[model samples]
Target: MTRSRATLALATTAASAAFLAPALPASAAVTKGLQDQEMTVNQPGLTPAFLTAAQEANVGLVRFNTRWDGQASAPDPAQVAAIKAFATKAAAAGIGSIEVSPNISGDASFNPRGKGRGPKATDKISQDAYRAYIRALATALKDVPVARFYSAINEPNWFRHIPQRGGAILYRRLHNIAYEEIKAVDPAAKVLFGELLPYARPTSKSYPHGQSADPGAFVREALGLTKSWKGRGRTASYAVKADGVSLHTYDFQADPSRKSSKRGRDAWVHANLDWAKADLRKAARTKRLPSAAAKRIYLTEFAYKTSGSDKLSTSKASSYLKKAWTVAKKQKVRSFLWYQLRDPTSTDELWQSGLQTRDGGVRSTWTTFKGLR
Candidate 1:
């Protein structure tokens, strides 16, 4: 999910109104029309423009990543300052919530070859360091008025991020640690399990790097691990401790509107959500993991590349975006965040999925997104 470099860029409440609103039924609590974007807030020139567009689209939520490796031992003063600035700016812009996922680059000492894709594989921060970093981050951002949501890591199922012998186990441990540490500092904040990249099949032929864990099998295994912890007298299963599950639905090599029947490793776009939800339900059936079934699904990253060989025409992209929202609504997803606000570069095929051109001009799909209810 790496992209070309570009330039950079909450609010709180009415906190009482949100906290005091009679709690809606679980189904009702699921945010049906809220839309968000996954943007690199640290990019210069980018954040301001993205914020303007978000306000125009009536988007209230924004998701971004903060690298734990960058702040593992001690808080990075610059990064912390940037975060604060971004939060302040966002709140003034009428944004309501900011979801930040800490990117955990694996421990190099444990795996010399490194785990994860590209630079992520070279991240050497230890588990304890990761815990310390998130705690520090949560404490630093606690005073910010905007609702804060924290996802422990980004895409654990991606091989380059967790390439060790027991990647899934390692991920579960990391997520639990983050959840505990974040809550200890900001109890009101919501902690989400790291988002999973939806793969149509359980495994891929792109060996080594791409033979990542199947999202379905990975969740089941992760939940089973959490369930076992309960039997060992842990206070609560990790499966149920986290607020929600995050997933990316980027229908690679297939049309977003097409349904996929294949299971375990299919990359079909439309079927990924259904398969993921079903997998969660199935995992929860194991008596030890019953609560897993109740978590809300957050589609945190989704987009269609517009310049790649598999690129969809701008008109087609609009149609797909519409359908994506329709499916998300039907699935009762808590949030539907598109991959990005602006393309990183006009030439990078992989990063051209943004609703706007590289220079921040609107694309055909921008109207489609703005029209989303």
Candidate 2:
């Protein structure tokens, strides 16, 4: 899940002295010959300091969000320019790939009036608009080799992000449009299904925010394992166009070793993947979607919050990071991205999941991450 800009205020507190420990040497243990595996940070910009730090740590991917708002049927020109600039700088810094998420925000001026934030159940954006925006984005970045991976949306399963009554169906439509638009511009480009917020069960009906759907349930609906929603059953198959799935797997606990007491479910780091894979396999068999079972699983966002109820001491966070990587490798995850590179310094613990303090001082997990393959 991407942090709202309001949640990323600079830290006012001083970095803890313990974070002053020296970074591991470059010759430190490196995973030899791992293929198609990437360690990335989901920072918004490609700042020089961040790029330098990422290079030193041998991290080769940077994922960031770009907006498709402020225009009726195209991305904002300024946002397009910024993406191009980001790609150029990332390549210069030796980053291998850049993942772009074309997120739709709640800004009224950018979206059709009355159809953005807190959208009514009947609100819907035309497919033509979605296709045009996606096509423009893909065309703008087509020549940039690092801009090979694109996500259709970000956390659409979350009600606030795409809050129509039949959000799952709406998101599937958007994803299909985006996949075609992107592939039309560059067939080699890989368009990922939008990342989903991991929730063991579907959001409760009485929940205050829009009706957030469970990630598993949304995937099932998309892949045709479940019947179409109230007004969304027209499409014969929603799975045919999707290339792969992306997930944001942040468990409630900071310690990955703690097993989920839920019977028949895998523990800790395996929680989301175990259930997701099972759902996909069942859908694939029922719907005959050939690649559904083997589709690449990208754990696009995974990290322990360093503060709040989920807070972990620096040492514990480091240990969790290492263990999480071990589990992801064993599970054959395609890409694992730490949610952020720097923590927000505010007293709010939810925003403090970075590997470094807000002031850019290295946290213990920075050392552990550098040593990961």
Candidate 3:
């Protein structure tokens, strides 16, 4: 369908109409589960072996980071080949859903183009490229059964990203394009919004003030959180555009010292997550839908890294995972997808959020997580 036609269909979902946001039955379908996929390395074309592992883990969703430039720039034969293979396996395993990001600034292609954050970017090419890229990618994956949900950006509100692009405009347009096209392809499918990074205000007195967690700030900005914050132009008007919302939690990032102690770590996880849950629900209520509509948050990307010189111990990792699951259940969250399936590369320590190590071997946390009901 043409872009204009697609938008016309979604635009029909006016604020006055009480539309039923249709979705697949959660009963026969899989319940909310962890995501185990990363960007650092390419797996062997989504092999049967990997499918077996994901199925064994009983995960309902296998999340993949769909980078717009990475795949579309060269359309890497191997990478495209892997995505097709992965989709097939996920369908067979009943673990379906692909969450994608358009503005992957850190990647070699976009990062060099410019620097700064939020929705209003100084780089014209980078910004325009990102929008066109997402539209193209969304069109490509529109037919994949396993590709159910689409998140416009990875984490735009995060300090590392936001300061470069600006926050409000980035998400508003991204979501506008994604929601319009995704629904056009399959109106029954669910499009999740705001995969916010979960972090709390730093407790350290050394760090300066005015910096809050990325997700919180994004919401505050997106919904016009404050009276003084001037909004970017309204390229796309906001409505209850998405079926669900998304958030990513990793408490370890909040601590300046990066301590692995039990008390310190647990506090970080709880406080940050609690803040996220409350903020998301509030945003959804005010900006998304009626106060009674079933607005939900999907913890799509979350994990504790323990592979550095002083990573969390295996026992500690397991404990953290358990506690996270507990909190997720308590929060009445829609679903929780862990950060990764396997650490596909060793190039960066941050890439080690997977349940398996660099070599594809399972971690104790993986074993513990696989047993979750």
Runs off by more than 4 Å, candidate 3:
1-41, 69-81, 107-128, 159-165, 200-213, 227-240, 253-274, 288-294, 345-349
How much lDDT does candidate 2 score? 0.58
Per-candidate RMSD vs. true structure? 6.0, 8.4, 9.7
Give lDDT tens digits, candidate 2, residues 1-373: 4334312221111111011111111222222111111112123432556667776777655566655431358776655554455545555455666667766554322222242345542264556777888898788777765536777877777555565456766777788788888999888777777578766333233443434566766666555554422223433655556666677766746445445654223221345466566555555555433464245667776777767766778887788778777767766667778766776544544556778777778889888887888
lDDT of 3 by residue, 103-190 (tens): 3433322222233222233342244555456555555655565536667666655433443344455565556666776576556556
| 271-363: candidate 1 lDDT, tens digit per residue | 567756765655455543445423577777778776766578888888888888888887787777877667655363345677887777888
Q: Who wins the TM-score comparison?
A: 1
Q: Give the TM-score of candidate 3.
A: 0.72
Provide the lDDT at 8 for model 1.
21
TM-score, every prediction: 0.79, 0.77, 0.72
Which of 1 and 3 is ahead in TM-score?
Answer: 1
- Best-to-worst order by lDDT is 1, 2, 3
